[model samples]
Target: MNILDDLKLQYKLGGIALKMIYWNVACFLVSLVFFYSFKVGVFDFPSWIALSSEPAVFVLKPWTFLSYAFFHDGFLHLFFNMMVLNFSSYLFLTFFSSKQYLGLYILSAIFAGVIFVLGFNLMHYSGAIIGASAAIMAILVAVTTYSPLMNVRLLLVGNVKLWHVTAVILILDLMQFRLENSGGHISHLAGAFFGFVYIKLLQNGIDMSKILSIVLDFFTNIFKKPATPFKKVHKNYQKPAERPVSKIVVKDKKQQQIDEILDKISQSGYDSLSQEEKEFLFQAGK
Candidate 1:
């Protein structure tokens, strides 16, 4: 297959993590066209799309809570966030389902956005934020909370406990809590907090992810088209005595043999097939 077809196939088969990466990358590319300012060399995201600290703007555009997580400020910002996202997704999916992974990502972003807005408003500050840092932190912290002692190998540090990595990140965020981009850091911590809470509640048999699923299903049903009812037909004409024979496809002997072998394999597995059958199937494949 060509490169585009290959990519389409990969996307169709890949898990939620890969799909999330694709979404983030696609959003970044679109942002570069409309949000990025060439003259100032910085992204100028609008209020409707980016998560704003002001209550007034957010109250009108509540969707920004989730939308902002997909856009990024710069190429480097997108690159680094995606890198960490892939790493965290790997660890998270090791112990969780893809549906949970997606639900956590979306819910965490919304939770973090809310916290960011609340914290900024309390401090009498105003600014907009974008990027998946908050969601990525949630995934990382969630997995680390569940498997603190899990071993993760770093590029130069070798193998280390998962909690060690999480702690370092948390400490850095805390140290810079009041420094540059405090709002961003606030959202990060909020997402981390949500992640921890999510695991705790899950241990108690409370699945927050199901909330998103229910909401989605409700909306889907609302928009879904109703099936048309079957109509009864009246008998208007008599049946013919002899109907013409429809065309029938006849397979060649080689193809017929291959089909038999495939059917056998499907029923009893490849190992159950005879040596002659295996060789015939292999040659047919080539």
Candidate 2:
């Protein structure tokens, strides 16, 4: 299949894990096009999209708080972040649902971005920030929080506890906070803090992910096509034909499965479902 067909298939089958990765890659290509086609300087990307460290500029473009997570500064930047994101996505989904993953990701990014702005301003630093590091860090810390003792294998490192991995990373970020890339280091900590907070609140029965769900639904409804008003039909219109028994069973099964998925979403959030489960729900929606 072509790229479009492949994207459609992945979006329909690979669940949020695939969709988030697809977006980051797509945005990277778009940036490349914008860089070359627009003939801008090599490092001079448009500021409208990148999260600005300047509080004044940020106030004007609030959406950048979240948009910045989808952008990056270079090839290695994108690769490493996506790598951690992929790994974290898998770990996170093992315990949470896809919606929870997204909620944690987006909220962490927003929180990190805002804190980056505030922290930098306070520290007398100034620069724009980009990349999904903050959000990715959040996921890493979240999974670590969820299961501190979970062991992970590293290349040439044998195996290590998840908390050790997270702690080492956090320490590195802390040690570098006053050095180069202070903005990034600060944002990383902020994301880390939010990740820790996310799970704590979840345990306390306050799902911060619901805020994202509500926001997304509100926007979805706004962009959704308006429904047609009711109108009387002709009395002579024939009744609709009944579906075949086989089709009816399939339909009932689909609906029943969909209901179960929805209940899971209500209770534990969407990150709890397996990829196969997510794909089934995606197909059911169609």
Candidate 1, 133-226: lDDT as tens digits = 9999999999998999999999989999999999999999999988798999999999999999999999999999998999999999999999
For candidate 2, lDDT tens digit of each residue in 1-286? Answer: 3446434754655668778998999998888777534454354557788888887898999999999899887788889889988888888999999999999999999999989898878878789888899999999999899899999998899899989988998999989977788888888999999999999999899999999999999999999999999997778768989867898888798789888877886578556777777677656656
Q: In model 1, what are the clashing residue pairs, if there are any?
A: none
TM-score of each: 0.80, 0.78
Q: In candidate 1, what residue range of length 10 has the lowest lDDT sum? A: 243-252
**Deviating ranges (above 4 Å) for candidate 2:** 36-41, 226-286
TM-score attained by model 1: 0.80
lDDT, model 1, position 37: 82
Judged by TM-score, which candidate is best? 1
* lDDT score, candidate 1, position 202: 94
